[model samples]
Target chain A: MVAFIGQLGRNVIHAIAKLGDASIFAVSTLRLLFATPWQGKHFVMQLYAVGVGSLIIIIITGAFTGMVLALQGYHMLVKVGTEALLGSAVALSLIRELGPVLAALMFVGRAGSSITAEIGIMRVTEQMDALEMMAVNPQARVMLTRIVACAIALPLLVGIFDVVGLAAGYLVGVEMLGVNSGVYIGETIDKIALTDVYAGLTKSMYFGLLVGIICTYMGQRATPTTEGVAKATTQAVMICSVMVLVLDYIITSFYL
Target chain B: MIKTKGLTKTYGNVAALNDINLHIKGGEVTVILGGSGSGKTTLLRLLAGLESPTSGSIMFSGEDLAKISRKRLYELRLRVGMLFQYSALLNSLTVYENVAFPLREHTDLDKEVIHTMVTMKLEQVGLRGFEEMMPSQLSGGMAKRVAFARALAMDPQVVFFDEPTSGLDPISAGVISSLIHETTVKTRMTSVVVTHDVQAGLDIADHVILLWQGEIIAEGKSNTIKNSDDPRVQQFIEGRPNGPIPFSRSQTAYVDDLTHKPGCVRLE
Candidate 1:
């Protein structure tokens, strides 16, 4: 039991060291960000790939989730003679918690895993070393692009999620659930101030940056072995997922 | 010119390289010969600044590598090109894009100039018209030639080859060796190749250094190596099993064990 405690302490220290290393990586990433124009093209392309590619899923999931929340909230509120408060409940959940966090989590799994695998394979195959030899900074072109792309992309994705989710809730509550259309739409509009929407967007931005930086760092440091790329890809996805959840909690407590 | 002093690299308790001191001059093809565990790749990586030496200094044109910033190191790297043993071509890029990659990154050259240079390099390596093919589509020799063309794309002053001719047929190997000779003459470049192919070294090297047990045991020009009196050198060049380096058994131990069989347990 003592040995186990010691091992756990050692592991915690190692993790803290890794986090410190990650902070240094962010510095290098900043250097890469300012150094090359290749980063511009790469950033735009990765943004398009991550944001546009995931558009359908984000919209569908947002719409259905909103509809289900509205249906349930209205039905439950009617039993308590407070069905008119349904709009605030759906809008609150969508803006304060669900929209940005869920969308960011989904993008991490989709975009972050691919970036990790691609970069890991590049490292193992010596393409990264070849880039260094060629006087081309791989970090600038690869990592910076992904980070900036995600920073731009995740907010836009969250906007899509927010508006689509709101629209879906409005439709279900007004047209299908027999709530007065004007009251449902007006109450939602009144409850969702700029602060709510902007806060969600801000959370999305942080999540996007987090996902890109962590995934790229893991990929670049992958071991040069046959299984290393696969392992990096898996670890990137797992870590990004957990980080998105944790950040969601922190942002929710702060913002909401 | 490149030089290393007391270059040592240790992995935990194991010394991959031990106090290696060497000088390589301009306009020479120096081959470093060694087996798998002999630290040839580690030496190259240390000089290339991909890995730092545990203790030593690497000086290129009198510039201390440790003192230079990464940007300056990158500038220095523009003068050095390395072709990996596996021909590390970017899979997503075609041969043309791969070769043109360095030029595009480092130079202000427009697309027209890059195209012209890429074509010229491909033609130099006799890989013309394969520019559109991906690295996965190329044969091993073809891939190696493509890698060579990419290395030559920047017209680097010093080129390093990590087993450039590893998987090629004899004919292709000859082409590559001659191409190295031709490119070096055409560009007056310094070339360093690490390989265990003794015949290839003999055929192309202006100078050769043999690495054993993390140290250089022999070094000379090709002709000097062939006629050298050192027994280990002779054993290596002649591909002999019996010499200073025993094949599978030490001579004293083998004789003693032979004499001390159960029937003749008392050799004395």
Candidate 2:
């Protein structure tokens, strides 16, 4: 029991120290982010990387998610003789929660992991040191571009996921299932308020910031070794995914 | 161009460099000679201000690197360049983009001027037409040459190289060494080279400093180093397997490890 407590204490201290380090890194990124000479070309390239690279995965996942939700909602509602409510249930679930959360998770897996690995490899290969030697700040050049591009890209991607999901729900509910087309379309439109969409988008933007910070932070500080880069990439994805969900709950509670 | 007073660097419990004092004249090629773990790279990094010394000062370009503000240090770094061991070209960028990186970031020169400058640097390294190719497409020697071009793109007053001829075929090594020689002669920029290759070091270096373990074992001109009678220097330059520098027997008994003794089974 004593050894276990000692181990637990050590882990807690390590976690706190890492948290402190990340906080400082985030502050430095923000400080450089608002300064002059906004790396316009690099930002566009990163936008392409984070936005376009993850497009297909987001679309496929969004479509299947809506289908699954519609099918599940149909069965449960039909048992209660409220089958017409299927459109409302599917739209509300996706617009309020699944769209942003799933899209952020997918971004973590697809683009965010690669971004972390790239910067981590830069650290290992002495590229960061080279940048410093060249009188270029790595935080401003490498980290800021990816972080800001990620913050902007996630909302746009999440928006696309929401629209595709609504359309896919329409396909499953009206075309494949026996629901009335007009009613399904009508309910999806009427059930979702402007505030609901706003909340989801706000969550996505926050998730973008969270994932961006975690990835760049983990990557920029990766131990200078191959095993270190691999570990950092994995940890960036895992931490970003978990943080997004935790943040989703906290933000949802505000609306409630 | 560079001077160190009692310079030492230690990582945790291991001293990578210790108690080193040296002066490198401007516009001269100074080669730091050492074996794999002799802390030569550590000395070069200290000179470049990439890492701070634990106990002493590194006077780079007349200012103490460890005592300067980060802003001041960055400003001072503008006049310096370094070629890393692995080239360190951005994998995602093309060769042209890599060479032009420092110029584009630091100077607001006209695009046409930057273009001409990058072309000239590439031509100097004999990679003139390979601009659009990525670093991954280049051979090891070609990559090193491109990296050398990138390092010289800024026309730095002081340049450092970390193991320039390491991990290359003899022909490639000869090409790079000659390029270093020609560039130094033409530009008259200060050059510091860290390498384990004795022939390459002696061939290009006007002065030589032999580092062993974490300290300076010998210091003199290239001829003095070639003719030095110090056993450590002799062992290093002669490429002997045993002497003051044993393979694994100094730290752990190799025979005991072969015999699987419980206390002496480990190797460093």
Most TM-score-accurate candidate? 2
Task: Score candidate 2 by TM-score against the native.
Answer: 0.95
lDDT per residue as tens, model 1, A149-212: 8888889988998789888998898888888877776788778788988888898999999998
Clashing pairs in 2: none
Shift in Å, residue B141, candidate 2? 0.4
Output the lDDT of residue A234, model 2: 94
Clashes of 1: 0
DockQ of predicted model 2: 0.81
- The C-alpha RMSD of each candidate to the native structure, in angstroms, is 4.6, 2.8
lDDT of 2 by residue, A161-254 (tens): 9989988988898888889988887887889899999989988999998999999999988887999999999999999999999999999999
| lDDT (tens digit, per residue) of candidate 2 on B1-268 | 8889999899999999989999999998999999888999989988998888998988887899999988898888778889999988888889999999999888999999999999999999999999999998999899999999999999988889999999899998999999888899899999999999999999999889999998999998988988988988899999999888876646776576576776554554
- CA deviation > 4 Å runs, candidate 1: A31-38, B169-171, B229-231, B238-268
Of candidate 1 chain B, the 10-residue stretch with the lowest lDDT total is B245-254
